[model samples]
Target chain A: MESHYFPIVYLFGNENLAVNLSNILMITVSMAIVFFVCFFMARKISMYPTGAQNALEYLVQFIKNIISSNMDWKQGKHFVMLGLTIILYVFVANMAGIPFELATQDHVVWWKSPTSDPILTISLAIMVIVLTHVYGIKMRGLKEYGKDYFRPAPFLAPFKVLEDLANTLTLGMRLFGNVYAKEVLMLMLVALGTSSLMWGIFAFLPTIIWQAFGVFIGSLQAFIFCMLTMVYMAHKVSADH
Target chain B: MSIFAIPYVRMNDKEANPLIQEFTWLDAIYQLAAFAVLLLLLKKFAFGPIMGMMEKREKHIADQISSAEKNREETEKQLAEQRRLIEEARREAKEIVENSRKMSSQQADEVLASAKQEAERIKETALAEIYQEKTQAINALREQVSTLSVLVASKIIEKEMDEKEQEKLIQETLKEVGEEL
Candidate 1:
């Protein structure tokens, strides 16, 4: 894969950092889309919602259900905003590359799903994991939160630490892998179509089918991401967990 | 060539590792910042107002329902009161009818008794009147009888002796008695 990099050198000339400009641009675009959709839906609210407002409320309710199912409302209420943000942002990011991927002839990708990149997805996962820890300490107090690690046996503490690392890796990689695979398959199909007329005809049907399936995968992945986020949050915050 | 080209870095296509190329702290930092901003804006503008509006609507609906229930109860109470009043009036009218009927029947009985008493008194007066008239006619007849007897005796004494003369006197006396009667 090709990328657009912007390098930043340390003032001491000790190290260099490369920023992926494509990811930045795509991430910003996705955020803007999510924000505008929410803004318009919430613009002229009424007692009885209709059209966009109805859809928006349904989304809110859907996130609320996900939160409530994992934990009680008192603990879950704080997470509704976080849940909405994740679901909307990840979903928009996942769907952004589907219709068409923007790239040069040399395969220099300028625009695609930001979530297809591991860095972005893992960043989101890290943020969520960090928030859960923050909330756990805030709600349960640090001593109680630390005691939660030793719950069935004091010997389980090491494995518990490993589990948090594993959880972060899987949560982030799951979204990245699915979206990346879909994009790769799409690119392959496009290449096959360009190779020959006969192949083009064959590739056309598969591409359309894959795009439709891609939509389902995108939406499902978004929901799964949110569900796991709340479940992880519940584990950290809830007394029973 | 672009405004974002100032920090341009040469491509490292030969690295042959997609994961190594994609992972960057700068991208992560930018994504985190962007996501945080989005969360803050959405919470303030969208979620807060909508949830508040929903709660208000729910309260309004509850108030309306309670007020409606109160109105229905009041109307029902009024209906019951009206029915009671109508029932009382009906009972009063019936009582008035009953009293008038009793009074009229009593008046009828008194009139009948007075009329019967008048008839009896009139019958007694008629009987007394008939008796008095009969007594007056009898007394007048008695006086005429006495006078006629006295006149006849005197004529017989005034003319006595010879047979032919006595017979002529007797005839004259008879004619005079008849004329006097």
Candidate 2:
């Protein structure tokens, strides 16, 4: 049962019993294992944090700092939830690419990054954009939101409205493009070495380089998603924007 | 923007493949759902603690700074007190030294005055003894001279009348010898 690299492997119904079971169960089990461990670690958090909780805190603090730095302590503090969610969820998605997809595949390719999928990326982006607007409207009433567009001149309001719309669309698309492009590039690089230059002396070097690049891009892209979320939110909720 | 979504097919060429994949509204819905999940998870656990810890860290740092400043001030104050104590001890030693010197000088002056008084008493007794001795010596000399004068007159009279004045002259000479002795 051969499959293209990172093809959407369905959870059930394949003719080969062994490979089908292997395909569906192993990756999901592994992800479930990661989820439960994270849950237990989260649940067991103490006043004096230990091991996994400490690691968790370090990640939490990192996002907290990012959010607080962008906005007011009170307003920024509220963004912590968003930051934490983005960091944790994206982190989980990014790490999904690490393990072997199935027991059958000699070189493991378990779970692809959820973030790499345009479906996932675009949804999160649009939500982030809408929430920013929602919070903006909440903070400064509908009148202020409308006034913000017309600010300094009543006539330039339409252009300003267009600019805002463009900005929101761009924000979402940018994240999708970056993550998708990085995943595609990594795949191509890996394919080039594994297929084309399998017997070539320099085959391993290119694969190694691209994998390293993949790791870097993956982490950066996750961070960028969260960063963009905070940036859009700050623009909306903050009085200055 | 919608042009990007349209298939880029080769209209002039007979052999061309249109791309199979297409973007759907379902994908957009999926994105929103994921974002909602992400936001929910963030709100529940992560945000509160991270922000709380940060605030705690900021407060802890501030406290440490204030305590450090307080400790420094206390140490400086202790050092000043120690220096002052040393200075005070030095002044006390000087006072003690000055007092001892004054006491010694006063004692010496008292001894000297007593010694001068003792010397005056001894001189006065000696002068009194010497006056008494001079008076005694003058009285004895007067008695001897008177007796000698009597004896001489008796001796001269005895020579003129040799045989008859012999007994009277002997009696006068005996009286002068007794006075001289």
* Number of the predicted model whose lDDT against the real structure is largest: 1
Write the residue-wise lDDT of candidate 2 on B44-136 in tens digits.
554445446656777888999999999999999999999999999999999999999998898899899889888988888888888777667
Error of 1 at A177 (Å): 1.3
What is candidate 2's CA lDDT for residue B123?
88
What's the C-alpha lDDT at position A88 in model 1? 97
Question: In order, how many clashes per candidate?
Answer: 0, 6
TM-score of each: 0.76, 0.64
Docking class of 1: acceptable
Interface RMSD of each: 4.0, 11.7
Minimal lDDT window, size 10, model 1 chain B: B1-10
> DockQ values for all predictions?
0.27, 0.08
Highest DockQ scorer: 1
lDDT of each: 0.83, 0.60
lDDT score at residue A180, model 1, on the 0-100 scale? 91
